[model samples]
Target: MAREKRTEQLFVTVPSFFRCPISMDVMKSPVSLCTGVTYDRSSIEKWLALGHNTCPATMQTLPSTNTTPNLTLRRLIHLWISQADITPAISKQEAADVINGEFDSNSLTKMIGFINSSEENLKFVALSNHAVPKLVEAFAKSDSMRVLELIVEVLDLISMENAVREKLNELILKSDGITDYLSSFNLVLQKGNTESKVKSARILELMAVNSDSQRKIAEKAGLLHELYSLCSVETETSAVEAGLSALLAISTSRSVKKELIRFGMVKTVGKILSGYDYSSAVRAVIEKSLKMLEMVATCTEGRGAISEDRECVVEIVKRLMKCSRAATEHGITVLWSVCCLARDGTAQENVAKVNGFTRVLLVMQSDCSSNTRLMCGELVKVLREKNMKSNLAPYETKTTHITPY
Candidate 1:
């Protein structure tokens, strides 16, 4: 009875082709060699690295040792694994043990597999078992890059739970564990690949729930800079948004806002806005950028940076009434800061140059909030006055209720 149960659990009926010829295990990363024979990438690579020029299974003389990924076979194996009613190879207790115990790559891989198999169940198990804190502990102590990446991937998965998220924030904000976790995250941000960076940024954003944590997170070396670097339009939209959301979380701090300005966030945001076309996907990024600009504009340096960037100011004006209501409000707030609050004459003139007068009026005619309408009034008055001085054609301001602050 015990032997039958073990055989049933072992996927004894797995296809011969699915197993690597050398390792006799199901191929995790199947690759085909020059001899048209497939083997697990790691197993074959290890064979070739030993100075053997022939295929391991067929002993065929290799023209070249280059291996191509057998994507079809890999997909089939994945589908079979998913459909098979096989029990989890790693139990919840085993996962907890691996995470809490000393670092083990093979065990970690099984833990990752178990978690990936059923994330919802594992989330509860992780929370109950205090898996997040253990993972953080592992994340800090691990020196291997692959191990660190695996740890981050698991953390990202479990972090979807609110309790798990709050626990992570506590770890970041707690004095005892702050250095280890923060430095580890900064290392990942600096050294990890794009996916890892995105995950780390998102994790940081989750931790930055309020001002205290945000300020603390911003204080970490090169963390803000790494986040800022991920905001390019050329990168994946998810990465760009992850970077922006992380910065936005921390931007409430005046000091952090200054750091962002020093890192050239204003110009980068403007360049992104200038280059991106309006798509459903890009609209969210635009809104977030405008909102961050508005927050930064609250500071004198931020307002100055926005005003000095001619294209940025123009893009700010162009965004009015073009995106969502929230985006329009943010754009107006940014313009109001530079033009009215800061009394930037150049920004006022740029507004007039972009036909911003018409856009602001369009905003006013829409169902904007009462405060936004008032800002529109002030913007119109400023632009009109600036245009009059510059001998530019004046817009007819009488069509809407105009009250200048």
Candidate 2:
């Protein structure tokens, strides 16, 4: 019996280097990762899609989701595929277009492209070699309003992280245009359309992330005034929030906080708080404004300003009686500052005039934090101590403390 010869094609094994460590198959479109390993574009892209931030083969951390195309390796793969009579799956030209910077025409496109490429794209772009430098170059070389707007968008995206904010501060300080842009943002704060003003405020907030920048911002001519104006009267809640946010950031500096108090920032913020219509968003506004006021009130100048503004004193006392735990705590801190630092019993007299003593005692008697209760109790004690001394005044000889009900 004659056996028919079996017709079979010989199998050729792919070279180990040519295969994707992820898919364990020959790389159709190879790209070099930052880890110095090559991977097929589709396989690695899928890996990134799965939220992996390290190499599958070596398990080394990837610096960015961005990968450089291994053009030579891909060409070799194409040649190998032809020689092996293997049908190509994906179009080479399409992959080439994807690899090249053909799609990255603008910051928005670049941001979106990276984000669409992988979930880790924001982290990657933020840490990319081009990101910070490009921001500097764009600010330096371009006067285009459209371009600046795009830069702001990029800033908003990256400023979510403190790490990126620090990097941004270093890079931006090097650009004269950026410095000018920040100083001139005061004009935006003054006269720009609401959206522009809001954007300007956001940029200031980013720059004010560090102490050096905070000092620069505080020293910038009319910058704080413009920000304070925005907080005080801007009808747009976004503008108000942005302005308050920047002030809050800068208020962390002792010198800045002193300057803000001298500018009557505490009083302005208190006014905003007092008039704010109650809503979920307004609750945040209330908290930030109170926090800022408390920070300023820690300084002598701030306490003097708060005491001078009868309305602010009234609002703090009212907030102490009506707001959330945080607001009440901040209000107590401000009142304590007012009581301790008020020149010659001015803060104490102001409280007595506005029924603030009653408000403090009410909050103290309520269910509040231990810290809040302690602060409230101290404020009352201090107010009564001042009242006792003030009773020695030539006009009123009656010696009686402020009675809390």
Candidate 3:
């Protein structure tokens, strides 16, 4: 007799539950996971051990686990083997076409390319009238940011239906949604198209609403400087307001605020007083910038004491005094901080730089805003107490508070 080769038969290949039917890729979580292939070897063994033969794949309801031996049982076994061979490449496309073209479930593939490569374009082109559940599975498994941007627009174009927007939002949340694009966000905002700018602003503001860590990630990703420049310069009031709001968020973050200061933002603040056309907005920024400056002034690590910073403040105050009355509430604030710090560090001679502090005394005496007036009064009191020949405001007992915001 010929020697018989001894070999073991192979077990069925059962894949993980996440494999996409369309693309055959492993699934990313938080998507539609289909239930299919299982690996309960114990269950299969239990079914077979009873000896009434049956195919587990068919899951047919039958009476006996053991069978009387016959060619019919052999034929059934042959059919089972044939079906197993067909399953991997089986009628999948026909199934996809049926759902996508008939049910309208499968969305168009989102376009993603350089410039034209956005997600919305692809979604439009690939969208079908039918429900391609597998194609949606394909999208879920292979998420690309380019696809999501497209979906956002597609949702909007389809009248922003709740289901679509919610779906898009889910996609966004899953992708952690482009929080790093903050580096280019302002350039997007500065585009000539008003609608585009508004949309960009809204997108950025929404990201800011996430947790403190998410917000910090956005700032580190480059939002702080871009928004700071836009807040003072954008012609559109809405854009400016939005930028200011972004700045406020940035200021609230201690670490982010420190980063902004280290990035040479102090000079940027110093420059805002003159270049911006909206005096009201400009003044608001001037006040904000000074508040930041005072914090810097109090910092212990510096060669200039408060005095060097005071010189910069004196210069701005002198410039404002030329058309000083036209300055907004925030402008007076810069003056107030300047004068307050000057009182702490300056002498009789440097006060000569702006008319011997006489002009500052005048702003204190006559300015209508109570904070400005009080800050102005405090400067005079400091000067008198320091023995400077300043016949400024007679120091008032009631004007105890000197800081201006």
Candidate 4:
């Protein structure tokens, strides 16, 4: 039968074709794609999804049904790869140092294309986690933003075990060059346009889950103008959300918060709250902004902590006044936090900055969100030290969302 002959040929020519073009490793645990190509176990899964029915090299159409092996290819791959020298010349401890010492932007860019077009190269990187040293070294010193991006993509996609989270944390802490990597990376954001913001957003999200990511970025020895810019982006909800969360983490460093407010975090958040392309996403952003601002307002004195011009307060008040029902809920929380911040030393000066009490009363008089009303009344109760006062009448209505064009 033709199928029998094809099977024989597959076994015969496999010595030459056993390597995945994408990963460049002997195709172990070979899984046949519907496209009629057999690939490394990890990668064939991807090929099958794209509806490819032929080998890229042989152009043979793969059968759509009934190709199951009595033995799954994982065993085969395990056998083949087990024979491979996956064992590092150096211990895992040296992974950071073993990375390409001269990895620059151009090299990283080339690697990106290679990783995209060839799985073999990706396999090499994945198998040799030790080589991360080379990548980090290159990204750390390079000025090209794209390299930083490519390197991050590779690290994130590589399979890391949840059990090893603690070990990885320790390893990263021992590793050098992360700060340099982020510093050079942040510079790229400053020079980049809209696309740059997108890249930074993704990087932040990926790093957000990393245990030491915030500390590493804060120590990166770069100005945060780029992060601030991403936070301000109005068109992209993903970028906005990532940027805000990134700021929240970075603000843990008192010095970092100073720089962020200086770069205009409050105003950018205000713009996001004022109106944007998506209400659902915008409201979500407002919630994050409220939470982040609460954390920030906690650590610093009113005058010493805020930007010198009181821009943050004025901007927040404006945002609260203009926010819709969803955003107003968060807006009130922020306002309440600010009210407390106003209470300590310079209570008069702080209150004077935004006419804190009046702003609270305005929300009480006109604001509709029940959550907002309760919070305003609470602030009055706290600040006025009131005892059963009738002047604190509350308004009850629903807030509206920003209308789309």
Best by TM-score: 1
The better candidate by TM-score, 1 or 4, is 1
Displacement of the residue 375 alpha carbon in candidate 2, Å: 2.8
lDDT of 2 by residue, 1-405 (tens): 011111001012455567665434456578988867788787788778889886654444577878999999988877875676642222333333333332222424344334323335545666665665666555445545544544554555555556777776776654455556564465446655555566667767877856777777777778887887788778766667778888887667678777777676866776787777654335557777888888887777777778788788777776664546667778888887777545436667777666566667777877778987887787777666555665522223231342221
TM-score, ranked from best to worst: 1, 2, 4, 3
Error of 4 at 320 (Å): 7.6
The positional error of residue 401 in candidate 1, measured at the CA in angstroms, is 24
Instruction: Please write out the lDDT profile of model 4 over residues 268-295, one tens digit for every residue.
Output: 6545545553333255565676666665
Q: How do all models score by TM-score?
A: 0.74, 0.61, 0.40, 0.51
Scored against the true structure, residue 279 in model 3 reaches a CA lDDT of 34
Worst 10 residues of 1 by lDDT: 396-405
Query: After aligning candidate 2 to the native by TM-score, how far in Å is the CA of 325 from where it should be?
Result: 1.2
- Candidate 3, backbone clash total: 30
All candidates: CA RMSD in angstroms?
15.8, 18.2, 25.9, 15.1
Which ranges in model 2 have alpha carbons more than 4 Å from their true place?
1-118, 174-178, 184-196, 206-209, 252-255, 343-346, 367-371, 382-405
Q: Sort by lDDT, best first: what order?
A: 1, 2, 4, 3
lDDT digits (tens) for residues 149-262 of candidate 1 = 667767765665678888877765875888878888888877877666777887788888887898888898887888898896337765787899899988787888998899
**What lDDT score is found at residue 31 in candidate 2?**
92
Count clashing residue pairs per candidate.
0, 0, 30, 17
At residue 152, candidate 4 shows an lDDT of 57
lDDT of 3 by residue, 143-170 (tens): 3433333322222233122343334334
